[model samples]
Target: MNILYIVGEFPKLSQTFILNQITGLIDAGHHVTVLAKKSESNHKIHEDVSKYHLLDHVIYYDENGRDSKFFKGLTFIKSIFSFGYSQLLHKNHPIHLSWKVLLSSPNLILLYNRLKKEPLLDIDVVHAHFGPNGLLAHRLIQMGLIRGQLFTTFHGYDMLRFIKQKGDDVYTDLFQSKTVLLPISNFWKRKLEGMGANPARTIVHHMGIDVDKFEYHPIKMSQDIKIMSIARFVEKKGLIYGIQAVSKLIKKGYNITYSMIGGGPLEKEFRSMISNEGLEDHIRLLGWKTQEQVIEIMKESHVVLLPSVTSHDGDMEGIPVILMEAMAMGKIVVSTYHSGIPELIEHGVNGFLVEERNVDELVHTLADIFSLEDSISISKQARETVLNQYNIDKLNRRLIDTFERKTH
Candidate 1:
């Protein structure tokens, strides 16, 4: 089968789940051509995947046209506004686009023409990554310009955060598609079902992780307890509360070290809080580590933390792939009972769970893990879950099964 994967960013190679899914399809003998918007960051792909072709970018505006204090402030203010009320601020894309496509119009004709040139001929299906992009692909298919079947994966923000308004029946038509509706957790599956999607097409398909990248090592326990989290340093991740918890633990004379990885919008603010709270030594921000580097960090840490929550703007995480990666490495995971997380972490069994954005609970959970005599045994069980369910081998089988069922 030939598949066209439409995404915002492709081949980031930062241990993202989308990359894992792409690689899995290739290994399963499906020819895939990734059509994506290139990122500003200079990232190199894994050598093994260099031969796989990708169309890096398409239509976009020059955001840096005019730089001034007013421009910068306007951009920041716009970001906040767009999130809280996406539908109001957004002009609806046409339900059916015109034959002439342009950046201003975002036409299906232009896209079909561009896609027709791909070397991966005989594309049996067009599988987009998110909802808005799916709307674009859907428009092409609805206009009778594309013969391939249309499909999409609604990652958290695409289905959960996107604002739909009147006259936007794009997803309504898309939901009726025979294409696969793969959600990483039941949370998304239920959300779509409530929105009146085709129940027959929906499947709780998981994004896989390559466990070979993260290996469990026999390391002697350190005197001070350690906690780690690897993600984009954003408001939704709730990294700030973890810092506050470390501060509270230190006041009680507990020895602990908190290591954070990844970089994002909240970098300076997080650093300032760490110093103002006098937690420079305890709270270390290892910004934007590579995939290989993050795997090494997981192996060294005592426990992995993912204190996720819905931000004030409703931006939240789906079941994060990093949590599975941590568990796969035979490390104890300490995360919250946030959206879709419980589906992955069984409280008191695979790892520990607490309420969202609760500092006191984090402190208590940390103390509980430190007090355990057979913590490694608990870690071993956590490892077993990943091997049985979360590893790429198992998840790949699930994905192939879904694809086969959908295509046949």
Candidate 2:
């Protein structure tokens, strides 16, 4: 089956799940194309991106328009006049044109010109990653610009803060037009249903990690425990709390080193906090590592700490893939009981969980893992958990099956 994925940005470091899914589908002998609003980051891209030659299959709408802006403008004007003339000729007949259709005419004109110049492949499924992308696909389809079965996946911000700001009616058109509404976690599935999404059409499909790439190695206990967090320095990640917790532990004369990997808006603030607390020696902020680098760092570290919390804007995680990557590497993880984290982690079984922003509990959990006799067992269990539930090969098969089934 031919699949076209619509996303806000292509080749992003943060949304590796999309890349994994695209590559997994291609490996399974399915043709997939990516249609993104923009391309991002001059930094190194994922290895699979080059291995599969994914850039060849990607279509950036803005980039295409930039090539012949004058021609596109002329075409846009011509299309509007042509459409208006047709409407006038059919004014005697009952013509139903909704406000949405009128509002989307400008974009439709641009899409019409783009398609005339370079047509897209025949698409069996139009899979959109976020709510806004789904809305864009709906508009294009409504204007007869594309043909496919619409499938929308709701991630963290799109379902939470986006809904809070735009209200429930924001997705009313998408919910009506979509063939399926996929949420990465059960928590999000329920939220979508509450917002009037058809329950039968809503499925909880997790974004998985490539387990083979992240080889499992039993964590060896060390006197100086290295705790690493591979997340953006954002409020929802609760990196500030992790820093404070580690600082308190360092004050108690514990031999611990905390390293944060990933860059974001909070980098300056985090650096200031680290300097103000005089944790320059114990804490290091290593910004943005590649997928290969992350695995190597995990091998050197004994624990992965991701203290995720619900942000002020209601943005939260939908079972972070980084946690799965750490678990797949046979590393003990300490994260919060927020969003869909509990679904992946069983307290004291596979990994440890603490209340969101609970510095005392986070510090306590880290101390417990440091001294626990059954640390090896916990690490093994964590690896097993990911292998069983969050493996990319297994999850991608399930996703393909869902896509193959016709949606009424």
Q: Which candidate is the best by TM-score?
A: 2
What is the TM-score of each predicted model, taking all chains together? 0.83, 0.91
Tens digits of per-residue lDDT for model 1, 282-353: 989987766777777777888888888888867767888888888888788888888788988898898888
Using lDDT as the measure, which candidate wins?
2
Q: Candidate 2, TM-score vs. the true structure? A: 0.91
Give the true-structure RMSD of model 1: 7.1
List the candidate 1 regions with Cα displacement exceeding 4 Å: 13-15, 44-113, 116-121, 144-146, 164-170, 218-221
The residue pairs in collision within model 1 are: none
| Candidate-wise lDDT, in order | 0.70, 0.83
Q: TM-score for model 1?
A: 0.83
Error of 1 at 256 (Å): 2.2
lDDT of 2 by residue, 143-262 (tens): 555678888888878988877876778889777765689999999998888889999899999999999999887667678989899887889999999999999888887888888999
Candidate 2 accuracy as lDDT: 0.83
Name the weakest run of 10 consecutive residues (lDDT summed) in model 1.
56-65
Error of model 2, residue 41, in angstroms: 2.3
